[model samples]
Target: MDLGVKGKTALITGGSKGIGLQTAIVLAEEGANVVVVARGEDALRGAAEKIKKETGADALAVAGDVTSDEDVRRVVNEAIARFGRLDIVVNNAGTSAAAPFGVVELSAWEQDLDLKLFGAIRFSRAALPYLKENGGAIVNVTASFAKTPGAASLPTSVSRAAGMALTKAMSRDLAKYGIRVNTVCIGLIRSDQIEKSWKQTAPEQSWEQFSRDPKHDIPLGRIGETVEAARVIAFLVSDAASYVTGTSVNIDGGKAPAL
Candidate 1:
């Protein structure tokens, strides 16, 4: 089935790698003009090239930090300048800024909130006009910890919880304009961040072993692939999920405890 997104345009932050890059590829596969935003010029260029080569869709790469208002302005402006319109906005720029509860620095807390919470707010505000005009979609990438926090999940868990609230608030407000707002609460997925964790915490373990070690804790017996999360995101942003809004979907392979 055509996702009914052909000729549409999408902008995904942190789109240089992992789930973000995979989402861009999937959207491109559905014939959407894609603009991928990230801080690394090299990675952004490579991601855009890969999308173009694999799907024959136009892909533009914008290198900028989402935490910066000036950079966010440039990202949105450049995307519209090239694509002529914005149909989807994926706020996926974030990392697990985990710190022990008591020792978590004030700066660290501020940083996490700024990047995960305010970044999504800024993107949504900047893209709201265009999305409203086009009756588009906004999908915020959050974490399952937003609903159920675990030990040492500070900053990230708190900020992601706020992100969930933001999604619901945006959905309520934007629905009048026909702009759908939703969120994908992530579980363990293969990504650069996870690789970094493996190297740091389980240096002696092979990548395969480290990857599987956590599976025993999850019902699926394996970490989710980036594309698996990406596919759910693609659907949420497509006409396929036209009736889906003001909701948060867990793409965790039954890892999250809450419904």
Candidate 2:
């Protein structure tokens, strides 16, 4: 089905790789002109080029860090200057800290929050005016741990909770302008971070065995693909979800026991 977002413009943070990249592809596949933002210039260019080649849709890659206000400005500007308008904004740029709660350092907490929290704040602030004009949609990617807390999920869970609060508050404030805001709380997915962990901890095992085994703690019987998460994000951003806002949708494949 057409997402009814074709010919619209979308700005996605952390669009260089992982779920963010997949979301960009999904949006482009539906005919949206997409501007992807991330810090790695090379990866951003590559991802954008690949999306354009595959979907034949307009795609732009803006290299900038989400932690910097200047960088955030550049991303917003690129979206407007290039696409002429912004209809969808996905705050998907964030880092994680997986250490034990007590072992998580103040520095790590600050760094992660700098990107996850301030990134959303700055991106939304800059995009709000333009979004207001278009009656846009905002989907902030958080983590399932915000609802299902775990001992090993430090900083990420706390930061995600804060993001959820932001989503609800923004939805309330922006609803007047037809700017819908929502959150997609993610769970364990096969992404660069998870791949890195598997590489270091259990290089011998296939991802299928490592992520599916009940002993590995996931109930889905397998690890999630980035595309799986992206499909949900794409739907939320679509006009089909016009009635959805101020809500957090969990795409944890039952790994997280939160209702």
Candidate 3:
């Protein structure tokens, strides 16, 4: 499938590693020019280099904090300056900040909201004008916990739930401009953080053995790969999914409880 995104420009937050990096590579493979954003300049540049090397696609690295409005605007502007047009925005920057409600301080809650919910808000708002001009797509990366919150899933759950709402509302409001907004609710996917947990919790076991352990309860038998989620995100942003908007797709390998 062509995906109909060749030559289009995509800006992805959290593109330094894991799912975000994989998504950038996938988009670039499909012939889309990509702008990779993250706080670490070195990581962002490395990701961009990897994308270009793997896909032979144009890739730009922009280092900035997503939680800052000024940084968000600068990222968008730099992308436009480099690519001359923006066709896709993937709000994929976030961390897994969860703790018991009682233990999670007000500061922690504020920081979580700032990084997850408001970060998306800032980038989306900053990219709106460019997206409007081209009739583009925006894919918000959330979590399955947004739909099925578990015990101890604090600010992350709340913030992700708000992200889903933002997707739906943005879809409705942006439809008239030919801009589509959707979200991917991720489950257990291979990532740097997941890798750290694997190393700490089961250092003796191989990654395959550890991930397939019954304790995780992933119905598909193991944790998902970054490419799995990346493919779905790529589809959502491509012309192949032109009619998909105001919807949430769970990329959890059947682990999420909700429909």
Candidate 4:
């Protein structure tokens, strides 16, 4: 399918690994110039190099923390400066607290929201004008946990739920300007973050236990792959999805039940 976005430019936060990296690769493969942003310089550079090598897409790596306003401004400014215009913004950078919600300190909860919720808020504000001007797209990368809201996921779930709200709000406000706003609620997917999570939760679990069949907590039985999630993200940012806006498309394998 021709996404019809070959010469456009996209800014993908948390683009160093996992779904962000996959999104970068997919967007570049479809002919979009991508600016990859994350905290680790090495990982950001590595992701850029790999995307360029594999997809032959023009990719730039910007290392910065999403929670910091200065860092966010720097990354966004640099992308606009280099690309001269931006067509897509994917709010994918986020992190959770070290401990689960109830057991953690107040600071932990605050930090979690700072990264996932407020981070998206700040980035959206920073990119809004450009999006209005360019008639671009915004894809907020949320999680199904926002819907399930488990006990062990207090901080993360709270912030992610807010992210979903922001998506709907943006869709309404940005519609007149042709800046479509949508979100992808991710279920369990194969990524470095998930591997780290499993290791922390159950170190003894083997690779077999984490297979990609629809056998996991998801009703479909297995977890999703990063690429699987990436495809949905690409679709949302593509011309093929011109009419899709202000919607939270679930990428989970039937794990979430909201209709």
lDDT of each model, Cα atoms only? 0.92, 0.89, 0.93, 0.86
In model 2, the runs with Cα more than 4 Å from the true position are none
TM-score of each: 0.95, 0.95, 0.98, 0.92
- Candidate with the greatest lDDT versus the true structure: 3
Compared with the true structure, model 4 gives a TM-score of 0.92
Clashing pairs in 1: none
- Better candidate number, 2 or 3, judged by lDDT: 3
The Cα error of candidate 2 at residue 183, in Å, is: 0.7
Task: Mark the regions of model 4 whose C-alpha exceeds 4 Å error after superposition.
Answer: 98-101, 197-209, 212-215
Per-residue lDDT of model 3, residues 189-256, tens digit only? 99888999999999999999998999999999999999999999999999999999999999988989
Clash totals for all models, in order?
Answer: 0, 0, 0, 7
Tens digits of per-residue lDDT for model 4, 91-114: 998865434655877887788888
Question: Residues 1-259, candidate 2, lDDT per residue (tens digit)?
Answer: 8899988999999999999999999999999989999888999989988898889886989998888888888888878888899899999998777778889899989987888988898998999899989799999999988986778888888888899999999999999999999999888788888899888988998987778767657666777899999999999989999999999998877777776
Task: Flag clash pairs in model 3.
Answer: none
Give the Cα-based TM-score of candidate 1 against the true structure: 0.95
The TM-score, computed over Cα atoms with residue i paired to residue i, of candidate 2 is 0.95
Considering every candidate listed, which one attains the maximal TM-score?
A: 3
